[model samples]
Every structure is written in C-alpha cells, then in structure tokens.
Target: MRILKTRQYELVEAKDIPDPFPPYAILSHMWLSPKEEITYQDFKSRKEDIENDVYKQTGWAKLKRYCDRAARDGWDWAWMDTCCIDKTNPADTQEAINAMFRWYQNASICYAYLGDVDAYGSLEEAGLIDQDHPMNEDLDEMPGMIPVPGAATNHMRTAVGRSLVNAKWFTRGWTLQELLAPRYLVFMDKSWHRIGTRESWAAEINEASRIEPKHLTTFKPTDFTSCSIAMRMSWASSRYTTVEEDETYSLLGLFGISLPLIYGEGRWRAFDRLQRELIMVYTDDSIFAWKLSETNQGFIRLQRQGQKPGLGILAPSIREFRDASQIQSFGYYGHKFEMSNLGLKTNARRWKCHNDHTKLLIRLNCGPEPKAHTGIMLRYAGEVFERIMDSELHDTRNFERSRDWIGVQEKEGKDIIIRAGNFRGPLTGPSIFTLRHPDEITVGLKYFMDFNVPLMSRKLELLDEVSLLGRLQLQRNELLLQPNQLMFANIELQTGEHQSRWNVLININENGFPSVGMASQEDRGKQLGDPMSEAKRKYENLAEDFHDQAQSEGCLPLIVETKQGISVNVHLFPRPPRERSSETTRDGEVYIEMREYTLKIIGKEKKDLNGSKQPQSSS
Candidate 1:
C-alpha cells in the first residue's frame, strides 16, 4: 500500500514510512476523465512538476484539498485511489481491488467529494440565508463562511441536495463499499465546503438508494453475511463499473471472499461464478429467488421453448436484485441446501398442485412449528426445483386461494413419479414435477393406481397377452402413460341415493403428457329416448356447431359430457391424407392408428366391443 505525505504531496510506501503506521484519511470520489485524473506513472515521472500546478486543475486540486484538510486535522498522511495504485501492474491492481474495503474501514476519516454540488449557493437557494442576511446581522461570522440560524430547518431539497443525491459517486460500484466501510464519512461539495456527515445524510442516502439505514450509518463486515444474500446484492444492483467484471470483483470484500481477477469473462459469467462461490458458504434460498422484470419476460418465453434451460433458474443480471428487498420478509429458516440436477434440494416435503396436475408445491418450514409455507417447484433442465413465490407466508391463502395440493406418496424402494400437464401459470411456464427425499431425488410420472373392478381385470389380462409398447408401463404402485396414447378414465358420480358410473376415453397429445383423469361404467343407449328429448336435441345441435367452429378455427374441440348420459347419433367425416416422400424428412410423419370402438352393455357390465376411441369417431 502507498500513502501520500500531506504537506509534500509525494507518495511513500507504507513499509518505508515508520515502525507504526500513521493515521491517514482516505479520499472517496468518482473518477474523472482519463486525461484529467493523474495516474501512477504520470505522478512518478513528474512528481515535482505535477505538484507545482496541482491546485490549478480541478481533479488535482481536489486531491490537494483532501491532503490539506487531512493535514489541518493533524494527520501527516492521506490516501487517494487515483494515483495510489499502479494500474499498469496487474498484481498491484488486483491487490488494491481486494483490499479496498478494508482500507476504507481502517481509514481515520473518509472525505466524500461531490463535485457537482454548490454548498453555499444551495443553502441560500433552500432559504437558509447566509450570515449577511438581516436576521444574522447581529451574529458574528467568519469570512467566506455561511452560517444557518439556529431556527432554520434541515431541508436539503435545494440544488446541493439534488446534486448530492444524483452525484456520480453514488452510481459507481466501488463507491458502495467506500460509503459503507468508513467509520466517519464527510460529504463536501465542489468548493471544498461541507455539506454534511454520513450520520446527518443517512436518510437521504437510504431513500435514494433503497439501502437499509443500518448499513449506511452503522455497518460492519459481519453485517454483510448477516443480511440475506439478495439484500446484499441489491446494494450493488444499480451500480456500474468501467470494467464490467469489476462489478462482481468490487463485492468480494463485502462478503470477505476473494477470487482471481479475470477481466475478459463478461459480467454475467463473473456474477454467476460469484453466486456459485457464495452458495458454498451461504445457506439462504432467497439467493435463488430473483424476480424477472417486465423487460426480461422474453427469457421466460424462451425457457418455454426449451431454448434456454437454467436461465430462468438464476438471474440474468445483477439489476434483478432490486427486488431483493421483498425477499427479506420471507423469514426463511436457514436450512442447509445443495444443488440438484433439477434445481435446489432441501429437507422439505413436496405436494402436487391439484388444480394443475403439472405444478408441484414444496412446503418450506419458516419457523419452529411444522406449519409449512408453500413454494412452487419450477422445472428447468428436466428437474424440478423450489423457489419462494411469496416472501411472507402469514397468509398462504394469497397463493392457495386459487390452487390446491395433494401429498405425494413414495413406494418403499421405488421413486415417486408425478406426471403433470404443462403449467398454466403466468409467471412459471411448463415445468416438470419431482419430489426429493433425504436418500434420493425422483423425477417422473407417479400416479396412485387404485384400479376399478373391470380395469384391474383388464390390466391383468393385458399383462399376459399383449406387450405394452410406447403406450403404458406398469410400476410397483404406479402406471406411466406415454404420449399420443389413449387411456380410459373411470369416475363414479352419485346424485342423492342413486349412483352412476361414467367412462371417458382421453388421448395424451405430443405437446404435454403425463395426463391423469378418472372414469367409470355407464350405459349410454338406455337413456337416449328419455322425456327430455327436446332439450337433448338442442344440446346436441350446440355441440355439433361447436365442433364445426373448432374445425374452422384450426383448434381441437375439447370433449364435453352431459349428465343425462344420452347416446347421440354418430357422425364421421374423413379428410383425405396428403402423401409425402420419406426422403424429405428423416423421421416420417407419425401415423397414429385410428381405432373405433362401440360400447356394448351386457348384464349390467359395459365393455368396448372393438378397440379404443379415435379422434375421427364421434358418438
């Protein structure tokens, strides 16, 4: 480290100064244009020549004034970042970057210079008249000094306050640590006039930057770790650096961690590596709770296209940390966590979304009580990971008001596979659902297979007769349905004392799979000619019109069932298939076999006489 002799305005190495280091004040200011600011080589080559006219140039004049003030305060040495660290030497540059926070913390005092503010004029503009005012005529005043009357209010809305709040000093990444690390910080305007101290202007600073008051007024290195990771990152979110990578490098000292300086590795990669290192020691899940602003919703859409996986899992840039203030209210328990292939895995129970079978919810324990708060498990890279949706779980009703959850059951040795459809939420796109346990993490479709009387017999007979091709797979306690396959869902409905069973055939499309529904037995032919034939004809005509409109709009008409259990007339319209050469494509068009079946009732039992229903067949 290099220290400057205040009186001589010459730099001296700390080792050569004396046995004990001198108490020195540090200058904290924004860097000026390269041509105006003095560099290490420029100072070394023309030390005497530069010092002679240093007071004439604005940049150099501020340095001289800082040293003069430090000397007046009974300090022999002062440190200024501009010419103190040799930028030409990589080792010196890296060392200075890593040790900057500690240097500010250890300084006797810090002088924060705001070159844009005019202290005296701003005070007068704010109605705090100078000593020359009639009200202060009776009071004695020093020359070139502006004194405010004892009755004047502390209103800093004038030009000085605006300049102080909007100063370049507040926008730099390095200035953040400079402002917080110092024990005593004094704000001075352009003419070297005092504006206020850190304590006096802390509220203004907090309002301007959204930083907590405790951090600006009374900050310690330990406070960095004590605060949530997202909150810490928020401080630097709006700040920028000349070199992009320095944004992350500037924050190393705040977290008390260091990494080798790699300048060319863009800002995103630098911050990504920093976050990876942070998670190694930090145990807060809020670090992964970055919110996407309206501008970055494109990234979310891209995630749906499978063009970008894991991009939504982590924040794209540091600017997103602006939302970190909201995450602090979550009051999350500091649970130790590890990164799973899907997402983050912790010791938390998982539940499936009842409204949308594709969505999964993980119960996060916020406090000592087992009352768990829910967070959605988003899919990225074929794995389901958990992220806090709402900060405060005081009323889980905020999210639970629309959705529902079912407890997941894992077979003794087999992993639980939860097959859900595409997520229909606005924020999270289509995501796979998975449940993670202490011993293992499972990802796949697992459904409770409580087969009805007839379906159980069919499953046993099919197991012996036919090979389950890309259609279905039988597990110990669950069944997996493949895509583009039709399956029967049996549901039992009860109205008063009378019970009726209905069976519906559904086909899982290629877009979203892992579908589940319930069905049961029903005799449609017997209820066709009931007393409500006129109403039934009207309903059938509406269904036909809807089917015609769906074909015209190029959308598939969703199947709708009526409670009357009536067998409407069947109709079939065949569209000619276009022929194409196999050489035009590597994988030929998928030929889905169309099988038409008629439901036949025999002795109170209903069964398919032929095969499964097809899209072309209608009843």
Candidate 2:
C-alpha cells in the first residue's frame, strides 16, 4: 500500500517506511471532475506542481488541509483515494477496493471533507443565532474544537445538522464505509471548517442516510452479519456512484467479499458478481429478501410480446431493497442451497399463495416475527415458476397473516431449482423454477372417487376446490414425496351431531399404485395414514417383491397427464371403519342383516367450505 508522507506530501510505499508500519490518517470526500482531481502519476511526474498549486488559490487546498491536519495530529502518513493509488493499474484498483474498509478502520482518525456544506455561517445572519459573538469562519481550530461553547450550541448544532443532512458526502457510495469503519471521524466543510465529529453528529447522519445510528456510532468489521443483507443494502439504496460498476464495487468491503474489478461490466453485472460471491460464503436467507420498490414496479411491465416472466431470482439493484429492514435470517435445520447457471438450488419449504394458486411463496428462513416466515413470490407458468415483483408481497400483512402456521415434522425440504429465467445476463430478465423431486405437480387435489355411491362414484365435487387445494397445500408444502411418503388434507367437518365427516387422503394403495379416496371420519383433528402394522404372513408372502398394502407411504401424490400441457395428481387414504347399526329378530317382521359399523365425522375445511368453496403444481 502506498500512502503520502504527510509533511512532504509525497507518496511512499509502506515497505519503504521504518520497521513497524506507522499509523495513518485517511481522507474521505466527494470527487470533482476527473481533470480537476489529482492522480498518482501526476504526483510522481510533477511533485512541485502539487505544492505550488496547494500554495495557490485552487481546489488543491483540500489536499493541503488534509495533509496539514494529519501532520498536526503527529502522523507522518495519510491516504486519500484521489492520489494515493494508481487507478490505471488493475492490481492497485483491486487491492484498494478490497482493503478500503480495513484501511479506514486502521486509521487513527478519518477526515471527512464535505466540500458542499458549512459550519455555522448561514444562520449567523439570521436572528436564530446569538449575535453577541460570531463563530470562527475556517477550520483552523484544533481537533475537538466546537464552533460555539459546547454548553450553548443548540442553534449551532441546528446549523450543523442542516448542513450534515444535505452533505453530498452522505450520498456517495464510497463514503458509506468511510462513515462506519473509522474509529473517529471529523467532518470538515467547504472552507475546511469543522462541522462535528462522527460521535457528535451520528443522529443527523443516520437521519440523512436512513441507517441506524448504532451502525455509525458502534461498529465492528464483523458487525455485517448482525444486520440482514437486506438491511445492509438498504443503507446504499439512496446512494449512488459515479461509474455504474462502482455502485457494487464500493460495497465489496462491507460484505467481506472480494472480486476482480470489472470496470466495464456495467452495474447489473457488477452486482451479479457481488451477490454470487455472498451466496458462496453466507447462508442467510435474507439475501433473497428484497422486493421491487414502488418506483421500479414497472421494471417488468414493458415485457416484449411473447415474453415469459423476466425477473431473475436476484434483484437488479440494491435500490430494490428500500423497505427490507427489521428482517433477520435464521438456520432452518437440514436446509441447504447450491447455486448454478440454472439458478439457486435449495431445499426449502414453500407456501401456495392464498389468493392465487398460480402464485407460490417459497418460505425464506427469515421474517419480522419469530414464528412466521416471508418468502419470495413466484407464479407458476406451466413448465416453470416465474418470480413476482408485485407490491402486494411487501405490504403490511407480513406476506400472509391469513395463512395458518402448521407444525410440520419436516424432513429434508424437497430438492428444487430456482431458475434464472434467462442465462444470457442479469440485465435481460429474472428467474423461474424447476423441481428435482419426481413429483413437482402444481398445487391442487380435487375429485373424490367412490364406487359404492353412483353419483359420487364418478367424482365427488367440493363447493370450492381452489380453497381446499390451498388448505391442503400447507399440510404438504412441497409435493415431492419420497417413496410411500403421503400428502394429506385435514378437513374438520362442521356437520351436526349425526353428520358423517369425510377426509381427503392420497396414499399409495395396496398394489403400490397412487389412490385418492374420501372416507367417514371417526374423530376430530387432522389424521394421516399410519403404516398398516397388521398384515399377515400369508399376505406378505403373496407377492414377495410387492409393497405390502398396510405399510404404504400415505398420501404420496400420483401425477398423471390428463391432457397436453396439463398434468394432475391426487391423494387420499382410508380410515378404519366404525358403524352404528342394530339388528333384531322380530317374529312377525323382516330380518335386517346383523348390524355392522358406523363413523362420526369432523373436518378442518368443512366450515371453510360452508361459506365458500372451490379448487385449484410440480417442478
């Protein structure tokens, strides 16, 4: 690393300096035009030119003041981006980008020169200030000096607050790390006058940037993990960089990630590289917790004719994470994610949307509440799943408070692929999905078959099949069933005392074929098929290789292609029979067959259907 020999204002490599590397002060500021700002080559070729210009009336004064301040603080070295490193050298650029955060952190003090703001002059002419004494006009005061007496500076603070809020330094992409990494920072105005220390003006800085004051006041390099990826990105949403690539490059240090500098890759490509880097090292699901801002909702509206969903699984920019705060990521046991050109392959449960069967929310392991979760919305498009950028997912209801929280004795989540819709590039579009599990049939389970009843034999239609599918979906979020694993729909029937309750169960039948059936319920609460533990030895030996009828995986979906471009699956299981009947031999009357059995009913979706009913997936 090369930094300036402060007193001489000459660049010196750290290896050229004495034994242990000396401490340095760093300068952070907004850059002027390329021609106006000095560069490293310029410093090497004409050392006296910098000194001559510094002594003259020019923009070089900022450089001079920065050096003078560091020298005053007993530091022989200072580093500024403008001239410390050769930007023309890719190696230097890479080193600088990677080490920026640490350099600021290691600095004993950071001088944040806000060339567009002031100390206390604007209000001095106004009656708001005490006219008894005028404040100093320049930053010649020593470190820690206050414009007004510390005890009597409310008006002075207000002036400083107004300036800090409007400072361009707060809006630059690079200055974000500068504000948080340094142990101590002093803000200087256009005239090089002190505005306030980072400690004193943290609130104003936070108010300006919408970042929490704690991030500014108490920060450690490792604190990045404490904040959600979305929260950290939120800090940069309103900030911008000169070169589009810098928008993502400037943020590399904050994430503890490194990548080769790609100056011409454009903003999207740079950001894409950054996200892919994070996915390699971080397991937090909050990385997927971004939504389209209201301003950019039309990002997908201009789709060309015949366009199938274009939004990728990853957002196009940090600006889209405007509202993602207060969300945290937690590990859901057995969860894993693998990234590929096909997109992110992960084993995570999903929730079929309540209002739209075609839309599903892949439950992220992060949420605003402890017991609940929010997911990225994806609309099923026949063969693939398209990501939804609609504002509804980000509104006040926390994704879907109306949805029930099911206690699932979850196994490893079904293996699924979240597809990046277009592999050409991120700027082109977003993503969709495909499932690696054998049965990724789109969400719905309707029609009950019973040969005993003629009309019902063909099919028993429910009042609302779509709603039932939604309710059924939660019980088995992912339709991927391991051999014999079943899917169940809990329906607590609301019929009167004599009401016969029925449940929809999909399980592998006696002959190892998928079967759907509705049977009378004997009791309340959701019931699933248990392995038939009573098959006799004769039955077990009947077909040596055959799966025993009693030990089938209950409710496993059986997807069959009912029509071109449309496939359907069904599931239901049997409940042991219980009959209420009586037979008496009356001498003069008829003899009814001896009484057998009866079943009492209870269902979860029975009442839900009483009001409204309807019906409505695979990889």
97-214 per-residue lDDT for model 2 (tens digits): 9999999988988999988775555456444556665565443343324434446546556655787798888889999989888988988877666666886776687789877777
Q: lDDT of model 2 at residue 210?
A: 78
- List RMSD in Å for every model shown: 20.6, 23.8
Misplaced by over 4 Å in model 2 are 51-57, 128-153, 221-225, 304-306, 331-334, 353-357, 382-384, 392-413, 421-619
- The true-versus-predicted C-alpha distance at residue 436 of model 1, in Å, is 61
All candidates' lDDT scores? 0.53, 0.58
Would you estimate the TM-scores of all the predictions? 0.58, 0.62
Q: Give the TM-score of candidate 1.
A: 0.58
| lDDT score, candidate 1, position 245 | 80
Tens digit of lDDT per residue, candidate 1, span 435-492? 1111111112211211222232312111111232222332232222332233332333
